[model samples]
Target: MPKEKSLVKNVMYKSLLSLFNIVVPIIIGSYATKIIGKDGMGEVFYADTIYQYFLIFGAFGIYNYGLREISRIRDNKEKLKQLFSSLFILGVASNIIVLLAYAGFIFFNYKGTSSFSIFAIYLFSIFSNLFYVEWANEALEKYDFITIKTIIVKLIYIVALLTLVKTPEDYLIYAGLISVALFLNNIISFVFIVKDIGFTLKCLTFRRHVKYLIMALIMANGNVLYTQLDKLFLGSNLGKDTVAFYTTPQNVVYMINAFIMSVVYVTIPRLSNILAANDEKAYLKLLNKVAKSLSLFLFPAAMGLTVLAREIILLYAKPEFLPAVPVLQIFTIYMITLAFESILSNQVMYVKKREKVLICFIICCGLFNLIAKIGLTKAGLLTPVTAVMTTVMANIILISLEFFYSTRVLKVDIPIFKLDKFKYLFISLLFIPITYGVKMIFASTVMITLVTMILCGSVYFGILLVTKDEVVIAILNKFLKRA
Candidate 1:
C-alpha cells in the first residue's frame, strides 16, 4: 500500500475496533443493569472502573513510547527485543504494584471503596488489558495481523460475555468470568503478534531500562488518570449506578475522541521520525495538516453531539438512561477541549518535553475535578451531570495550560482551539432546526435518526465548503489528489 493508504488503514481499523470497545462495554453494562438492578450493576461497574484506574499503572506509557521506539528501531531485532522485554518487565512490576496498592486501598477502604476481593478480580482485568500492547504491531503499520487478532479476541469476548452473563444473581461472578476471557484474549493476541511480527524478546535487564520505564510509568498514569479518574471518583463518592449513568455520555464522547486520537496516534511515529531527521519545516507542516484535519471532523462532531445529545442518547439506550442525555451534552464539550489538547500533547511529547508538563497538568486537572465533583455532589447535583461538568472544566483548564506551553515548544502560535472552528460552531448551531424538525416528523426513531445524521453531515460539510475553510480545503485537496 501507498503511505497515505497505509496510514488510513491503521486509523480506520482501530477506529472501527475502538467503536466496539466503547459500544460493547455499554451493552454489557446495560444488560447487567437490567438483570442485576441498578445497584448491583453499579457495584460491578465500580469494580471494573476501579480496576481500570490501576490498569493505568500496568500501561506505564508503553502505548505511546513503545510504538514510537519500536517503529524507529524496527530494523534492529536485538534492540527491539530489548525494548519489548524491558517494557514487559516494567508492565509486570507495575501490575504487581497496582495489585499491592489495591490491597492497601481495600484494607483502608480508601474512603469507602469496595471490598478487596472484588478489587482483586478487577486486578485480573487490568492484566488482561495489557494485551493492548500487542497493538504495537498495528503501530508498526502491520494492520492485517492485528485486525485479524482483534476480530478473534473481540468475537470471543462478545461470545463469552453473552454466554456467561444472564441474571443479576451471578453479576459479580459473571464480571470475573469476563475478566478471564479478556486475559485469554490478550494471551492469544500476544502469541499471534509475536509470531506475525517475528521479533524475539530475550533477556533484558531492568537496571538498564529503568529510566525509560519510570518516565513511561509516569506518563501512562497521567494520561489514564485524566480520562478515567472521574469515573472512579464518581463511583466512590456518588454511587455506582451514578457511574453507569455517566458511562453512556462519557463513552459516546470518548468514541469520537478515540477516533481523533487514533488518527494522531498512527501518525506520531511518522511525526517522530521526521523530527528525528531534523526536518523542521516538514514537522510543522505535518503538525498543521494533522491539527487542521482533526479539527474539521472533531469540532463539528462534538458540537453537533452537544446539540442533539438528547436524541442520540435516548435513541440508543433505554428510558432509564435518559438522565445521561444532558450529561452527554456536558461531556461532549469536554471532547471539544480534548480534541485541541490532543494535538498539543502529541506535539509536546514528540519533542520529549511532554512528560513533566503533562504530569503536572493531569495532577492539577484531577485535583480540580475531585474538588469540583465533591462540591457539586454535596450541593445535590446529580452524579452524572456533576462529574461531566467537572471533567469538561478540567479539560478546558488543561487546554489553556497546554496552549501556553505548546506555543513555546513548537515556536508557533498553536491554538488547539483553531480559528476555522467557527465554521463548525456555525454549522453546529444549524443542527437545532434539524433537531426540531426531526422531533416533529413523527417517523420511526430509526428513520429519523438516519435522516437527521445525514442532514447534519450534509449541512456541516456544505457550510465548510461554501466558506472555503482552509482546513477542509487542504484535507480535501490531499485526500482527493490521492483518489
Candidate 2:
C-alpha cells in the first residue's frame, strides 16, 4: 500500500493556497476597481458570470467525479491511468461542445455589439478547460505542487494586470489576462498529470460512469444556478453596476468562506478512502473534527465581516459601493450556510454515494432562488441587498433539507449544531460590541478594520485557549512540537 500523506501538511498547504487566492484577488480587485470604476468592473464581472455558467456546462461534473474516482484507484497505476484518460477525454469532448454552444450564443445574442469583444475573450477559458486536469493531482494529494504553481502563476498574472490594464476600456485586456492565467494554470497541471499518469485512450470506458456523471452534472448546474443566477438577474433587471455592488461584497464573503473551507476540502479524499475501507468510526471521527474546525473558524469570520462590512467595502472598493454594506452582512449568513452545506452535500453525500438525494435537494434550492429573485425583480424590490437576502434564505432551506435527510433518511449522524459549535458562535458574537467600541475611538477606516480584526482574532482564540478547546489545543500542540 502507498503511504498516506500527512493531513496536517495538506491542510497547511491548502490554507496557504487559500490565503493567496484570497489576498491576490483583494489586491487585484481593489486596484482594478480603482482604475476601471463600477461600470467597467461590472461589465467584466457580468461577462465573467455568464462565462461561468457556460464553463459549468463545459466541466460537466468531471472534477468532482474524477477526484472521487481517481482517489479510489490511485494506488493502481494502470487503473489510475485508464480512469484519468477516460475522464480527460470526456472533459475535452464536453468542453468542445460547450465551447461551440457558447460561440453560438455569443453570435446570436451579443454579435456586432461592444460586449461581443468581452465575451469573445472569455471564450478562451472554455478551451482552457480542455487542459484542466487538476482533479487528478488533487486526488493524488499533491497540494504542495498545486499551491506553489498557483502562487507563481498568480504573481505573474498580477504583474500583467498592473502593467497592462491602465484604463476603463482595458476591461477587455482584463478579461483576456484572466483567460491567459487560467490557461497557464491548466496547461501546467496538464503536463504534470500526463507525466504522472501517461496518456492513453485504449482502455477508456464511459458507459459505467454515465449515471454518476449525470448526477454530478445536475448537482453542478443546481449549484451554479443557486449561486450565480442572482447576479444574472441583478445585472439584467437593475444593471451591471448592481451586479458589481452585489458581487463585490459577495466576493469578500466567498474569499473568507473559501479559506475556512480549505480545511474541509483537503479532507475529501481521505474521507472517501476511509468510507471505502468501511471504517465507519474513523469516518465519523474525522467528520466531527471537520465540523468543529469549521465552527471555530467560520463564526469569527462571519461575525468580523458583518461588523466591518463598511470599512471593508471602503477599503477594497470605491465609496459608491457603500450600498453593498448590507449585502455583505447578509452574505455573512450565507458564509455559514455554505460551509455547512459543503459538509452535508459535498463531503457526506458525495462520499457516501448519495448523489441523487443531494442533487434533488440542491435543485430544489436553485428553483427557490430563481423564483424568489424573479418575484423580487417583478415587484421592483430586487436591489443588491434584497437579492442577497433571498439567496441566504434559499441556502438556509437547502441546509435544513440536507440536515434532515442526512440524519433521518440516510441515518448519518453529523455533529452540525451541537453545543460545542454554538459555543464558537456565542464567543464570536463578541466581535460586534468590540468592533463598535473600537470604531468609536478610531477615525480611519483602515485603522478600524485592522484593529477590529486584530482584537477580535486575539480575543476569540484567547478564549478558545483558556477553555482548552480541543481543536485549538491540538493545533497549538502540533505547532509547539514542530517548533
Q: Who wins the TM-score comparison?
A: 2
The whole-model C-alpha lDDT of candidate 2 against the native structure comes to: 0.89
TM-score for all models, in order of appearance:
0.85, 0.98
Q: Candidate 2: lDDT of 395?
A: 89
Model 1 lDDT vs. the true structure? Answer: 0.68
**Please, what are the lDDT tens digits per residue for candidate 2 over residues 1-483?**
323799899999999999999999998988998789899989998999999899887888988898888888888899988989998888898999999999999999999998999999988989999999998888899999999999999999999999999998888888899899999999999999899789887878988887888888887567576668888998888899999998899899888888899988898888888887899999999999999988989999899989999999998998998998999999999889889888998788888999988888888888889999889988889888888788888889999998998899878889988998989999998998999899899999989988998999999999999989999999999999999
Q: What value does the lDDT take at residue 242 in candidate 1? A: 80
How would you encode candidate 1's per-residue C-alpha lDDT over 1-483 as one tens digit per residue? 213445555666766766666676556655655566656666766777767666666676667677667666656667766777676666767777777787677667744554455666776676566555664675467655655666677677777767776776667776787787778767876776566454444666667556665666665565344546667767767767788777766767776677666667667777766666778778777777777667667766776777667667655566777888888888877787776777777665544446667767767876887677667767877367766776778888877887777777646656345565445676677887886788688457666667778888898888778978886686678678779
Q: RMSD, each candidate, Å?
A: 3.7, 1.1
